[model samples]
Target: MERPELPLAQLHAFVVLAEELHFGRAATHLGIAQPPLSQQIRRLETKVGHALFSREPGRVTLTSAGRELLPAARQALTGLADGLAAAREAGSGRAGRLRIGFAASLALTVLPGLLRTFRERFPAVRLDIQEMTTTPQLAALRERTIDIGLLREPPAHDTDLAFETVLTEPFVAVLPTTHPLAAQRVVRVEQLADSPFVLLPRAVGPPLYDRITSLCTGAGFTPRVTQHAVEWQTVCALVETGLGVSLAPASIRRIRLKGVAFRRIAPDTARTRVAAAWREKDPSPLIPHLLAALDHDPSDGPRG
Candidate 1:
């Protein structure tokens, strides 16, 4: 037997009429005239192949089939409403995860405050963070492994990616508190030229590392790199243990590592630039919101 597929409008009319049981009341509840409300009930009965209402003199009651249909109609409407809400949330980027790739050097200097702000504004977004270098992060972005990257300066020209500067802090010398140069409020790069330098390998990022080396060379000395660490924190850790002095962004001062002193370098020797990059024309809605969060000053910390 071919049964008529139920329509939501008719089911709604059936439910409202069933609950009220009076044509006048049901019509008012549905914001319709009594004649139309009664006609809709008749249409629903015809479609269901069952007389849903027992018409009597001055009163009405539900039949067996109508009673059974009531709960199913309400449950279906509730499910539909919940489904629409979930769809809206996902479309607005309020639900779903964002994969972020960042250079290890920035993990301590710039990432914490940036992430805290992003979370406060979009609590439902899941942040999947990965520690990667500038060069690799480029490949990650191209390969679609990560949605955004926090990295040092990229090549001068690239059409496949877009980057925005997040922080451009001058280089600061991280020295052991006991080091003679640490006694000064600010020390020039030339002063540390003769000292054993602790630095991350140039492979980590040629732009920043080259800037550091070029400064030493311009200061008339080739830095004797005595130690190499993958992250800025590790360099400070090495400095704390009296291993060797290292150059880092001024933001590294916030680390407050015991036994390490951070001092500003000479004017214009080297600088550390941090930028957030993503696919040039990404379709994902999460990128813009993430970029806005990254645009703030980390020194200010998360907004109120």
Candidate 2:
């Protein structure tokens, strides 16, 4: 059989009266008239089906029933208080989970510093980080699988999503260490016109791929296609084999392949931009806090 529900007011009065052992004093502590205090204790005792206090002219004390209920009542009140505090913290964006998606290449640049800043400011919030390419990151944000995204070359027109540019870096040339252009301090856009080009497929990242090809076109030639790789690391590795030359964000220099060299592109006008993206109409308090963290300057320290 299920037990009956006892009102919190009765339980509170019972505990105070038990502690004080005097109706006058308990009523004073609870800031009520003595009659109401007595009535509350009576209601509680009736609910428990027992007389809770033994009343004598000069003395009052707990019956066995009241003694048994005191500890449980105190525990219930404490639990409720704790639960309320946790709810408040979650509502304030100081606690709960924040899922983020980021491009693989960003790990070499702004990802770490942005995370460190957010973690420091909201230490109790749990971070769920996923490494994905630009396209996958966008899809995850739309599907609500991720709360924030750090990606490169955000789409120009996406009404469902909003983006903020966090970093913009110039393109650099990646070539075989033995290549003649590698010996020079910088490579011009036209320098690699006739060279076999190792580039990412447009399907993988349209904007970034178009930027590279546009740079070549602006220099009066279309790059001779030779190889395609989905990842920058793979692209650089292919270049290392002397299969072709490639252009990548300056941050790609962090990849340490002994057979490859990274050189600045002269005129340096072509730059890849990384942005933080999120759904425009979704209301998540954690998203705003993360956006604030992104406002801090990204770390420019030496790459690993």
Candidate 3:
């Protein structure tokens, strides 16, 4: 036998009527006239090929078949309602997990404040943060392992990645307090050209390491690099021990090493451009929320 298609609206009406157990009240609850509500339930029962109710003209009673199907019908309606609500929330960007990658330096400079603000505004959002080097950060972004990255600059190879400048930090020279140059208020990059330095690993990013070396070259000599560290803290520790002088972003000032003094470099030969990066093709709902939290001003030029 060919079965008739069930009407979803009529099924809803039948469930409401079954719960109410009164024709006139169920009609009111459905926001319709009693006759139409009764007609819809009759149509639903016909589709089901069974009597669903015992009608006493004034009172309604669910039949054995209606009782058997009622729970399933209610469960379906509940599931549908929950799904719609979730869709609405997601459409508005009100809920979801955001995986963010950041360099160790930003963890000291801007990340703390940004996260505090983000948490206060969107408490329901789950933020997963990972510390990664600039090179690994771009790779993670490209592989979709991270939704966004707080990095010094966008990768040169990943043209598909978009970058928004968050902060332009000037370079500062770090020296041990007892070092001879530490007494000077401002030291030129050329003045430090002859001094031994602890430098970032060349593999961290060629352009970045080159930028530091280029600044020393512009000052009329090549840098005397002594040690290559993967992270800024390691370089800072080396400087504190009087092993070598090093140049770092202004955010490094926040690190309070007892023997280290952070001084502004004269002529300002180098600066770090911190930017928020993400794949251009990826469409994550958390993008706007994270971008808003960054509060980056497009007009802020690179630090001199």
Candidate 4:
């Protein structure tokens, strides 16, 4: 047999009567007269192909079928209400989840404070964070996998992504405590040009690695690279082993290695620019809240 189409109005009346078990009270709750409420329930019973309630002189009792349908009817009505609310929010540009990407290094410094502030302001917005390299972060932003990015550098390609400088961090030299240079108050990049160095991995960005090498060159000689590591922690670990010295952002000083000593790099040859990037044409309500959060600088020392 074909199922009859259910009317929303009759469904509402059925739900009310199912709960109150009295047509008079149900009508009062629905703000309708009892006669019309009774008529609507009768009509609904016809459509459903079964009597929902047994009507005696003074009392009304639900039939077995009515008991079975009550929960389902309530669920359907609740779902409809929720769907309507979500639609309204979407139309107003105030709903949906926002996915944000961040480079690993930035997560140690600025991301936490930004996230805390954003959550406080936009409690309804869902935030999803992905930690990725600068290259992949830009790619994710372009592909719509992420709505925004906190990264060390601006995008290399000319996509429609806009970037705002969030923070600038100076460079510091990391060396084993036993190394002679570790005893100096401040070390210059040129002074370490002849020392073995642990370099950032080539995949991190040849340009960035070359920039480090170029700084050494400008200091007067080529660096003797003794090891290569992908992450700042790995580079610090290698330095602790007396493998070589490395130039890293001042934030790296936060990562305490007992054998590793960090000193300011003279002339500040090591500095990295960090920015918040997003797609120019993307529309997301949470963006403004996130931007506001990123605008508030948190006073923190570099360590991770």
Candidate 5:
């Protein structure tokens, strides 16, 4: 035989009647008339296959079945209430998992502070972080593999994706300690015209790679790139071994390599940008909350 549904309304009525042990009082507590409350108790008892209350001449009292049903009914109502509250929290972006993709280099700079602030604001939200390079991060955002991306040098035009610049830092010179230019407090781009360059390949980060090259070109010489490394640390390691010099975002200075020196570029006008990216019309509410957190963070640079 098919099971009868234990409707919440009926169970609620049962618990209230069990507590009051009086039809009129329980109906008053439930904000209903006495007859409807009596009918609810009768329906619940029918489903339970037992009489729940004994209506005597002067007093109403619980049968053994009603006593047993009270606690379990109360528990079911409490569990439903908790579940509904959690669902509301998740809908408001205060709870749930947020998948994030970021460039590897950003971990050394803005990533830590951004994540800390997000966690403090929404402690119940779980962060799923993926470290990837710029191109891959963009692809991940497009594929829905990541909900958002923190990457350097977002593309100039993408109809399906939207980007907001979150950080900008001027480029600095990376050189071997023994290089003559390293002795100077600041280096000029034109000064490195004769030196070999160790840089991240254009394919790895085209916009950043092109920006570095343009700086050299503006100084009247194209960089003679003798070595290519996919990561800034590796590029710095090559420079330390005297393979060549490089120009990188100021944050690259955070990598402490004894043999390499990072010096400010004179006139410091040119800069590389880092941006937060997402699908143009992403439906996840978490994205806005995260963007708000990024905006309020002290470490976030001026938006572009």
Candidate 6:
């Protein structure tokens, strides 16, 4: 059954009159004349289908029905006020969940600070971070499964998505501590051309994978691939076991696994770039707070 829409004005008048037990004073409290207040009480009784007041020789009091409804009527007004407040919060983007997608490389360095600042600035906003590769991050953004993505540069096929570069750092040579080249303070790209390489699969992020391979080609030889891995950490793990030397973003240096040594390339050949991306048309108010929290004049920091 449909609930009746209670008369809000009548409820206000009835409650005041019940407290004062005098029509004139109740009307004064309500900022109205006594006749109008009295009429509202009569109207309220009609809606409730019960006589809500009793009069006896200059004495006024609530009948049994009015006493029963007094508490419930106040509760209804309180609920209405609360519901309106909740709706306002939702509309203002001051409260809501933001699903953020990020590259695994960020976990060791940038991700922690980004998260910490975001929490401090917007304590009420919720965050759900997903570790995804650049390719998958782009897909998730398009599919709307994730609200925003922080990863490598996306494919240049769409103009509707906005990509903002946040960090750009040089790639470093990752080698097992036992490697002969580990003796050198700086390893040239050409120096590692002969060593079998541990490579991240192209599927993980073709642009980054291709860039790594091209660094070897630029040094006058194609890299000899001895192992294929998915995550950059996995590539580093294989290099740690002496499978081969791998090249990775400088940020990977922050991931300290035993038996791994990071070496710089002469003049810093290929740079790893990090960017935050979202649809150009996305109008989430949460975006401003996020961008503000992460805001900084990015120095040429050596990280992924």
User: Which is superior by TM-score, 2 or 6?
Assistant: 2
Best by lDDT: 5
Q: Which sections of candidate 1 miss by over 4 Å?
A: 1-83, 104-110, 296-304
Better model by TM-score, 1 or 4? 4
TM-score of 6: 0.81
Query: On lDDT, who's better, 4 or 6?
Result: 6
Give one digit per residue, the lDDT tens place, for model 6 in 199-271.
Answer: 8778879888888888888889999898998788888889999999988888899777889999999758568
* lDDT (10s digit) by residue, model 5, range 151-262: 9999999998988888888999999999999999999999999999999988878998999999999999999999999988899999999999999998889899999999
True-structure lDDT of candidate 2: 0.87
| Candidate 5 or 1, higher lDDT | 5
* Displacement of the residue 110 alpha carbon in candidate 5, Å: 2.7
RMSD after CA superposition, every candidate: 5.2, 3.7, 4.3, 4.3, 2.9, 3.6
CA lDDT, candidate 3, residue 249: 80
Between candidates 1 and 2, the lDDT winner: 2
The candidate scoring highest on TM-score is 5
> What lDDT would candidate 1 get against the real structure?
0.82
Candidate 3 RMSD to the correct structure: 4.3
lDDT of each: 0.82, 0.87, 0.83, 0.81, 0.90, 0.83
Candidate 3 residue-wise lDDT, 1-304, digit = tens: 7857666688799899888999888899989998999799888888788999997766678999999879978887888898898777766777777899998988787888888888888887789999987888888888999989988855555667888878777888899998888999888888897789998887775667877787888889988888888989888898988899998887888888899999999887467788888888855787888888777523333432
- Arranged by TM-score with the best first, the candidates are 5, 2, 6, 3, 4, 1
Q: In candidate 2, what are the lDDT values of residues 179-298, reduced to their tens digit?
A: 999999989989988889999888878888888899999999998878999889999999999999998999999999999999999888777888889888964678888877777745
lDDT of candidate model 4 versus the reference: 0.81
* Residue 265 in candidate 1, Cα distance off native in Å: 1.1
